[model samples]
Target chain A: MERKWNKSSLMGWQFVALPSALILLFSFYPMFQSLLLSFQSGKGTVYHYVGIDNYIRLFSDPMFKQAVFNTLLYLIVQVPIMLLLGLVIAHLLNNPKLRFKGFYRTAIFLPCVTSLVSYAVLFKSIFAVDGILNKMLLSMHVIQEPIAWLMDPIWARVVIIAAITWRWTGYNMIFYLSAMQNIDPSIYEAASIDGASKTRQFFSITVPMLKPIILFTAIISTNGTLQLFDEVVNITKGGPGNATMTISQYIYNLSFVYTPNFGYAATVSYAIVVMVAVLALFQLKLGGEKR
Target chain B: MKKLTTMVVHLFLIVASVISLFPFVWMLMGMTNSSSEILKGKFSFGSMLMENIHKLLDMTSLGAAFWNSAIIAIIGTVGTLLLSSMAGYGFEIYHSKSKSRLFGLLMLSMMMPFAAVMIPLFRMFSGMGLLNTPTAVILPTITTAFMIFFFLQNTKSFPRELLQAGRVDGLSEWRLFTRIYMPTMKPTYAAAAIITFMNYWNSFLWPLIALQTQDKKTLPLVVSSLASSYNPDYGIIMVAIVITTLPSVLIFFLLQKQFVQGMLGSVK
Candidate 1:
């Protein structure tokens, strides 16, 4: 029995060993190396230990600050809007009386199929100075002139936000829709029978019932927004004076686009890690405490 | 008044659906229109489809990019599913206190942003003389913690009785895993495959950095350059985008149930 137990345990290690090793090498090891790299200031291989310097630079760095501010603006503004839109859509679709549910669901969920870059490019062209959107708006007489959407800082950010919202709203909706399915309809039925309005039922029941999923979507959206790279890079190019530049794009620019500043890029990368850690912790707290 | 409200609701939904699907429609139309014609808001399909395809093929390594993307996505998805399922199974089926702790640790890595690890990963891959290879992209992500977690979560409902039953039949542990466990987890594997495949297909940041040369770049990377170019041809770019997007979209539609199941698998 002792030998058999030992053999089984060994088999367990055999299964897990390679994958764990790969994770340790690829994920954990690079993470540790990045931490070490963060401390040393250098362009490329030539480097020296500059303890606390990169961390200090982060506080006053304008580009860093702008990136952080833009990312948070997206987080604060876009996440709530997208999630709310998703919830509303999901709720609407959850209605038994709604016609053509399949068509609506599929049509609305279609945007998520586009690759991030493809969508960004699409949005970019549509919002271009003389692009389709401008032409449409012109025909509608909404604006006398083309908006120069991606060329302006503010409109560029809006376009970025709109692009992201377009891509992910369906994704979040699917989650809410699935979670809504698990909800017993009798609760909503009871509420309605007791003279509750649809709005009140949605707020009191659907929202509350989908709290965990809401929290889950929030965490992922927050995480995705924090590490936002593809859209910002493709749509705006973090340009019109870096208004839509995310920290990830900033890090990419630092390490690769500009003269490769490995150490400082690593430092900039830490800011995202810290933000993700904080937001994730705060969300977990928010979710757990409410539950 | 109730009828009016219902009309308003339907109108809102119709508007939203149109807004959502307009880009896909425009993209398809752009294939048949010239760059200027597209910018001028030509809603109808023009005669530029063959021209766009020819120009895209002629001007870029579109074929090689597609081939590379396919190879990477297929291999990466297979590897991710197999290895992650193995670890998930090992940790679940052969439960131990240490394995649990290790898994918890692995989960922590999931929260570590790719930006943080990317520089080092690039350096690590470069050092190993594997920077330009598909191996670099696949290796780091091959055994992701989230995939492992997904597999572990799905594996909970797996029948342990089957494993015990297999053991009694005198099959070796490896044989039991390959023959029995894998066969039973087909749905979970299918779900994971679609998600992993899409991820690999659409992956950009890492591939943008890793695959430097024209010949080795993925479709997304190629499309990115086309879009970013000074004299961008919207017709050709649209064709390239369609090609890059078609496989995943097809996969999503074909195995859509599994894709949704896979996505929700993580949330659960």
Candidate 2:
């Protein structure tokens, strides 16, 4: 059966043209609009074309600097820890002989599905000055006093990082677990017959095989952490001193929390864009070659 | 020694699951306790579920907000599935050098953090008098490039011979899509639906900025407001959280089969 390539047939122009145009409008237009918005400066009703003042001001703004620091802190500390834990857990669970694997998988994966409000509320309670964590620590004689996890600046950041890692590690695990399923079990059997220990086989075979997925999750997780807002806003409110403030939260505050500085807020938003683009380019260059 | 190691791993997993499941258990326990009791770390179940429910029902427009969320999620998911899958299918099926270049550009959009776009998005929505509508919340995300990219990646596994056969069958372009493409991609559609529904359902920032009134607020926004009260009642807030989370969990469980399979297909 010969497939016709006619105007009205399955390979027609309208088929591709409509979807392509939709992408151009919905995906491209708002982005271009944002690019334009970043260049202008104004209050609610007043407006002016400030060529690069907003971008220039970002370098000097103390709060913006703090937010940049906090975001990067999370990127460095939280991303590696979560990915590593996820990798370990996925390796353990990939054992076909492992007991109650389904239960373990669901239990970890369950956290990601928990509603943001529910988990945020739960985390706030668990990390409160007199919350379960402190209670447990005192009961176990780990500490004689209750720690102000959310009130102290350094501790507050710790709690935020811990909360993010806890919530997302399972999500990353799902990616790894799914990727692991594609591996032939015979390979593991082969390794065992050749006298490779479990840990050795994991490091040698599993890590290298799952490198693409690891990189993919790393990029996605980086994007997620870079846009970190809901957790900070709900859990910390960027507060006690701006210890846990993120760029997204700062952008939110600029746009809605304070007197609305739409133009300036757009500029801060673009800073994140530039950072993500550079980091993504670097990661792709670093990881893409190996794949 | 082998038994000891296995025992340790099992113990570790058991402890981890308990820790993981503690909050959910607490949420339920909190729903059953009073505000003061919850704040005081009362871990056991109480008899206040009905009271908490009553208080939450009276404090907010629970029915309207839930309805609004449902409508938005349902519509947004449907729109996302159709438009994104169309683009995804187009990009994968009609693969060309230019289309591939365009695909790379679309992937770049996925990397741009939403924080970078929120304010400009707000201004754009406000300019169109869309600040307080479901349309405002759903329109911008309806054709998200991330969703498009996801579908495109999954479409890589879609058999080309099926399309060739459909063409041989003298089916029109639309018929090939509606007849051949749609049915074969049920797993993909299911996964996309679950993800998009949750995205639209639990979406907080955009809806918070866009929707101004009490009636238009989503479950998350309403819960946020509830939790923010100067003297927030933990029991009541827990109830709100449970309500907000239930639908997504239920949707995920309902669609888990396809969700995992679709994702597996994409990675391979």
Candidate 3:
């Protein structure tokens, strides 16, 4: 039943139109302004149009390249592990015989709820040169001396990846768990009656069922990891010669920490937009078509 | 082997929980210890909790900062829910190809990292002479694409028959939304309010950029700046962290039932 468009109806449309227009204005205007600013170059308040120069400079800049590599590395390495672990744990939790489900769920989910400052401080202390981790490793005969988890380049990246995975796996698991609740238990029962192993049921039934939400979380996680800043900044300060610097952290440093290179920073920001758009497009193509 | 695997998963979950809770435990212990004892990594309670609390109160304008955070969060959350839910209701009920394309474009904005736009956003506010205003921080955030996306997703399951019935009863569109749709969507609104409040209360970046004066600083920014000092007092920082984290946790605890209830509607 279509409601006829009337005066009050038109007024409601007008009201909705105004807010949507304002939202589009704020969201698009700054983005376009940033695009314009990216073409111009200079120190604070003095600038000139330098079309393609900022892009060229970005291409040539070693730091930007390193940031790109680190962000991509984190994206490639961390996303799959977190998603798989989330799926596995979620499947296990979905088991009918699993006990203490609330305790397990809350325990795993607590990491993300911890304030960012505490997590940073905690990680820093635990990974310090003579920290508890090293002491444990030494006494356990796992290491000859100490592993400077944050000071070394490779180990620092590993630690950051581990940190992200630890904090987010449970969060992603919650999404899967919530999604799992919507599935009919009868389907799993049918699978078990057909003599499907739990592992077989997971791969064939659960994974296929969760494909869309999995893709949604995956894309969001990609964007999140690509823009990773807080943990890196707070934990290592993107330190040891920018070994762990992410695109977002680099953009932050360019904007605030170093000289205010707003133009190049905007260009770098567009790089993130481009990457996320590409990945999202691919995800939609692969996952969105599913019913 | 199955039993062994179950045991391993249990062990892993226990370890993760300990690691997760360790910082909170440490922060509490730090609050109860002298600064020297904290730096020495004292892991137990001491005689210094009251002293640390007194020092925190004396040194910083914690009361004012807390009030500022509350005010901003409340206003921001309320404004966001009203405008965003309105738009979500409008779009979902009135879906067209054009509006769908516009929604797609809106989701694009959500993916762009906030840091990339930080400078231009700061410049825009400064140019508008709005620096140091809570409005400067609250306005841009209130109409977030993420929240809009959330509302739109939730609104998809909204019963359109309610609107048809309202129209049949000769209700205006706005009246239909306010009377019928809004009441039915109470659970969604409650969940959105909690998430939005937590987000605003924990917001750090934009406030740090826009708010310049001492009185304007929010709790997280104040705690961060305090922690950045040359001889950072671990005891006081611990106190400040506790203060900063309490409101979000409290809000979560209060609204968690609604939150979990709404999650089923959300993930679809």
In terms of DockQ, which candidate is strongest? Answer: 1
lDDT of 3 by residue, A26-126 (tens): 77778888888889889898878998999989888999999999999999999999999888878878877778877777767666555565566556655
Q: Which stretches of candidate 1 lie over 4 Å from their true place?
A: A1-7
TM-score of chain A, all candidates: 0.96, 0.93, 0.94
What tens digits encode model 2's per-residue C-alpha lDDT throughout B1-268?
9999889888878876887778878888888998887766777899999999999999999989999999999999998899888878877776666666776776666666777666667777888898899999998788877777778887788897997899788987678888988899887898888878878898988898899999998888888888777888888888888898888677667777765554343555
- Two-way lDDT contest, 2 vs 3, winner: 2
**lDDT of each candidate versus the true structure:** 0.91, 0.82, 0.79
How is the predicted docking of candidate 3 categorized under the CAPRI scheme?
acceptable
- Model 1 superposed RMSD (Cα): 1.3
Off by over 4 Å in 2: A1-13, A16-19, A288-291, B96-98, B159-169, B262-265
lDDT of 1 by residue, A1-291 (tens): 878766786689878999999999998999999999999987767889999999999999999999999999999999999999999999999998889988999889988888999999888878878788998899999999889888888888899889999999999999999999999999998999999998999999999889999998999899999999999888878998989999999999999999899999999999999999999999999999987
Q: Give per-residue CA lDDT, model 1, range B177-245, as digits (tens).
A: 899999999999999998899899999999998888999999999889998898789999999999988
For candidate 1, what is the recovered fraction of reference interface contacts? 0.73
| Every model's DockQ | 0.79, 0.53, 0.43
Ranked candidates, highest DockQ first: 1, 2, 3
